[model samples]
Target: MAPPGCPAVAPVGKWKVIGHLQLLCLLALAQPGGPAWPCPALCQCFGNMTVFCSEEGLRNIPEEIPPSTTQLFFVETALASVPSRAFTNIAGSSHLTTLAFLGSSLEALGEAAFAGLPALRVLEISTSQLTALPGEALHGLTNLSTLSVKFSPIETLETGLFNSTPRLETLHLQGNEMESLPSDIFHPLRSLKTLTLSQNHLAELPGEVLAPLGSLQVLKLSDNNLTCLPPGFFLPLVQLQELFLDGNALMELPPGAFSRLTSLKGLHLQHNALRGLLPSVFAAQTNLTSLYLDNNRLTELPERLFHGTPSLSVLSVANNQLQALPARLFRKSPCLTLIVLSHNRLSRLPAGVFQGLPALTKLLLSHNNLTALPRDAFANLTSLEVLDLAHNQLATLPEGIFDSNIILFNVALKSNPWACDCHLAHMADWLQHTDALLNLQTLCRSPAYLKGLSLPTVKKEQLVCLPGPGSSRCRAEGLEPSGEPGTLPQCTYQDPVGAIHLACDPDACQQLSLHLPGQHFSENWTLGSGCGTVRVHITVHIEQDKAQPGGEAVLP
Candidate 1:
């Protein structure tokens, strides 16, 4: 999530993202006739009571921060430490609502460093060398609301650190080295809403640590070593909506573990060591919508696991060791849209397994051991769009298997050992007419004569039934299209490092437009009428729903 006043855009690389915000500031101290707001030496002051200071050499805070200043950002500076009464110069300045220190080497913070700022609300000390924050450091900010000390080396948080800030709402302490926390440390934050404690070494949390934040909504504890959750650990977060407990070492969840999170919506338990889950574990998450149980050691899921979550939308159990799934597993989650069951050990799917998911659009069954699917398995998915059945052991699809998916546009049948015989004539004829797109490399892997032929480019006459009695089978294969205009469209994908390598045909068009399938809007760029590749980092956003993890996709 972005800082208090920042727009909702993800940071790139890490702490350096904050430096990008500096580019929006007027480089000059004060625009020629912008505003009279005092521009402290070594700082750029804007008309909107904001000051940005980013320069090396001088140590300590700038001599002065205009008393009328509302937001102050310090990035890539050599200034270090905030001695006692460090902000005494701006004491009692209620208009100063935000103070952030990014990419700095400030290691020490005096006990009374922020002594008397009455109305200060947001304080972010990110990506610094600070090892600890004194208990009384935030002594007099009575109305403070957001406190972010993230991406620092802070090892521990003092017990009474928040004794003075009663109105605090958001606390982000992720990316630290803290192993444990004081039980009553959060006993005073009655209005706290979002707390992110991810990327830490915490193996366990005190039962009462989060008992005070009844108003808390989002709690992210991902990338930790939490092996288990003590009973009642989440009983206090009655209003919590989203919980991220992924990337942990949890092995099992007792029945009724989350029976009290009635208002919960998103539950992420991916990348853990869970061996199994009880059907009642999520019995009370009636409002749940997203559940990520992928990348685990599970072998099976309870048949009625989701019997209570009727509003469930996104469910991912990919990358597991399952051999089979109970056919009625999703009988209650009628709102499901995205289901990722790839990278599993399953060899078969029970008929009617996906019968009632009218809202499902994307189904990933790739990298599995399945050889065939029940003919009507997808008969009820009227709204299905993207289906990935690649890298499986299937040789042929049942006739009319995909006839019900009228709006489906993308199907992945690559890496499968297709027979390219009578049964495959349906898929070949469908590919020749329908608008559905498949991988260009989808090949036939049977009948020695046409072993490596691309399925999409095969002639319908060559898909006749195998030789019988005196009949003979032969190959009249068609060549794969040259992917030029009027042929196959270019496809682009995002690499693991988040760079889009776009290939444009300078001679074909003057502008390049990218429209990600399923996205309400598109990203367009002009290639400047030149040639060569341009690599740039990207921050993904979706017009609807939470931005899902990045992956490969074909662009038209």
Candidate 2:
């Protein structure tokens, strides 16, 4: 591992983290211009501590290593074996803390190959042809803290190979062909904190394999062929905070499987065959923050699954078969920020479903079957910034649905089958009010005449009418209200069913008048969807206008 405060380099594949001091050593390998020394002819020395060699045909270990060298790396070398006492000449004086054999063809190791390097803290052998190591391969390295033997074909490990290094902490055994592990292989390293065994062929693990790693904090077991986890498999990982179980064949997680891992903060179970999750599976994980269960076969999640995990912030359950969610499912998780429920079969959202998530910033419900949203759907989401309702069956939004979202700036309402009618006047009014709204235009997909027209350019009058009666034959032609300043066209629309919807230009301020003979009725009025400047509406009943069947009830 790099020193305590080394600037971090972005990790590539399984490249070990190295400091700038070590990076200079690598740069010397390609440039061959570091300070001169009595170094091996093919090796380049950096300062007084690091030596790097990358000659392809070199057959033996360079015997002239500087005694001040504390770090050595052999890249793409032909060195085949490290005989006993191979580095004894300089080990005592060098006090090597890091050694690596990358892209090497090494196949065997002498029992005491690392004898005199007692201060070694990091050792690695990756992209090599090494097949196996004897039980005593690491015979005397007691202070080593990091070890890696990745991308090698070694199928098995001697259970006693790590007996000499009890203080080891980080172990990486990924990219191997090992189908199974010896139950006692990791029985000695009690101080291990991070273990990576991904991209291997492990189908199952021994029940007692991880019983000794009680201090492990991160366990990565992704990209394995695990079909099922043996019961009590994670009981000993009480201190584990991040666990990656994605890219496996597991179908179900037996209840209480993670009951002991109360410290878990991030759980990745995506790309699995999980059909469902039990409500109490995470009852003890109150500290959990990010949960990923996307790309699974989950048909539904238990309503109270997240009730115990109030600390959750990021949740992605997309690419599942879920059709709906409980109304108060997230009542307890008030800290959620981003929720992705896209690519599901959800047809509707329960009112107040997201009313408790006041801190939510982005919510994506794209690619679903949602037809409409309730008016107060986002009542408590005053902090919401990004909302995606694209690729659904949404015709329009309910009136004042976005009134509470004052800070919302990014919204996606495209790709929906938008019916351009009076019901959609509210959407146009919202667009007019929020002029800064991105994705300004969407295609109207209904009413053959308005089909292919963009919503932003279409006049409000062209985008109106209730479902039946004279709603479609809109006539914005009649007498203006008395004392009105402008010669505004009277926008009249009739709805026999309880309400009449209308839209007009705010500048003209249209005055609506209706003439009904021998009939009068009570009135109920609300805000109109016109320019939003004028208030209109008072129900006028019509008994039977034998001359006009479209219900022109009251006299102007």
Best by lDDT: 2
Off by over 4 Å in 2: 1-36, 90-93, 432-441, 470-556
Highest-scoring model, TM-score = 1
lDDT of each: 0.75, 0.76
Please give, for residues 308-414, the per-residue lDDT of candidate 2 as tens digits. Answer: 88778788999999999899889988878779999999998898999778678889999999998899888979889889888999987887788889988677888
| TM-score of each candidate structure, all chains considered together | 0.79, 0.78
Judge candidate 2 against the unseen true structure and give its global Cα lDDT, from 0 to 1. Answer: 0.76
What are the RMSDs of all candidates, in order? 17.1, 10.3
* Deviation of model 1 at 285, angstroms: 0.8
Write one digit per residue (lDDT tens) for candidate 1, span 1-556. Answer: 2222212211226443433354547442354444475566677777647777787764767666666677778887887887787776752245787888888888888887876566678998989998887898888878889999999999989988998888999999999999999999999899999999999999999988999999999999999999999888898899999999999999987666687889888899999999998877888887887889999999999998899888777889999999999999888877788899999999999999998787888999999999999899899787888899999999999999988888876888899999987689888877875443556778988744356889888655455454344322111112122334443233222223322223333223211122234433223221211222233222333333434433222122
What lDDT would candidate 1 get against the real structure? 0.75
